[model samples]
Target: MSARQARIVHISIERNWREVYDFAAKPENMALWASGLGSGLEADGENWVAHGPLGSVRVKFAPENDFGVMDHIVTMASGLEVHNALRVVPNGDGAEVMFTLLRLPDVSEEQFEADFRWVLKDLNTLKKRLET
Candidate 1:
């Protein structure tokens, strides 16, 4: 199935982009702010296994880089893959974090909106954690 629908949920953190990226890019640290991974992540060969809000899933993340990209793909128990594009960009003295939320096939508008809010809440959680 094709995922043509998209929404970007973003937040501005009062911290350096590099610092934000450094912390958020680590899979083990995601559970601290990213509620979906509240159970945390553990190494599973090339990917990480997270017993998240969506049940157990395999996550493949992009290699660490200087460009502040935190992209990752989550593979569900049924092998449904969802690509998540996340980025931390410089915003004056602070940082802007963005997450692209895709409304996959058969997702209703209400569910998509809820997903958008969920992403925003997660970003805000990150902001609160880092800005402290």
Candidate 2:
């Protein structure tokens, strides 16, 4: 299957990268944008764990400079597994977060596209909340 990509539109609130990074990195703040995720945020080493619809999702965060990237494995409510990477890049004004959803070989492209769109909408909501 082909990879699915989506972009979240956002404007910068505070120009300081450090402030942006810290706010975005906090797990509890995730619910401000995303749905069906972001509760029970916990951190161990460089990883984060959150209770999700599927049960639990473990995220491995890689942070550099003012940006952070994460690899996510989510077990969906339907028992399907999804793997994706999320990249948060500073827009030089604020930040633009991009999610690249990888479609597993056996996964249907339609499913991947639909889910990716949902994620983008959620992220956009999150951006507006944060920037406000």
Candidate 3:
């Protein structure tokens, strides 16, 4: 079965795909763009810990790969885990960065919309940072 609701928020950058991936895929670099991780991530064993409004969450990121896969799993303090699928792919001479935003069960419509806007805003911030 498919997710009841989802959105693919993306942005195009005038840089090489590998370059975009190299920077965007870094956990440290995410704080500069990702709002939810704005407090930044701290190293915790094989995973990273992000302290947010809901409390500290364990984040496990996909190992560095050449295929531009930057997926990661976020385990909330309550033990609920959310898988975030992020990627950077080639597009003409530039790169297209995409983030799959899934609306978890019981999330209000307004909150889901807010999440979509947030992801797009983050992606735009990424594009601005990488382009300059």
Which candidate number would show the highest lDDT if scored against the true structure? 1
Worst 10 residues of 3 by lDDT: 1-10
Count clashing residue pairs per candidate.
Answer: 0, 0, 0
Residue 122's C-alpha lDDT in candidate 1?
90
lDDT of 3 by residue, 1-132 (tens): 664688899889999999999998888988898878858999989999888665788899999999999999999977899999999999888999999999998899999999999889999999999999
Q: Model 2, residue 131: what's the lDDT? A: 64
Worst 10 residues of 1 by lDDT: 1-10
lDDT for residue 22 in candidate 3, whole number 0-100: 94
User: Model 2: per-residue lDDT, tens digit, 13-128?
Assistant: 43444555566556667666667575655776766666766477665544444446644655554556566666666666666566675555555778767766777677767566
Q: What is the C-alpha lDDT of each candidate?
A: 0.93, 0.60, 0.90
Q: What TM-score, to 2 decimals, does candidate 1 have?
A: 0.96
lDDT of 1: 0.93
Q: With candidate 1 superimposed using the best TM-score fit, by how many Å does residue 67's alpha carbon deviate from the native?
A: 0.5
Residue 10, candidate 2: Cα error in Å is 9.1
- Against the true structure, what is every candidate's RMSD? 1.1, 4.2, 1.3
**Residue pairs in collision within model 3:** none
Candidate 2: regions farther than 4 A off: 1-18, 36-38, 43-46, 63-65, 70-83
Give per-model TM-scores: 0.96, 0.64, 0.94
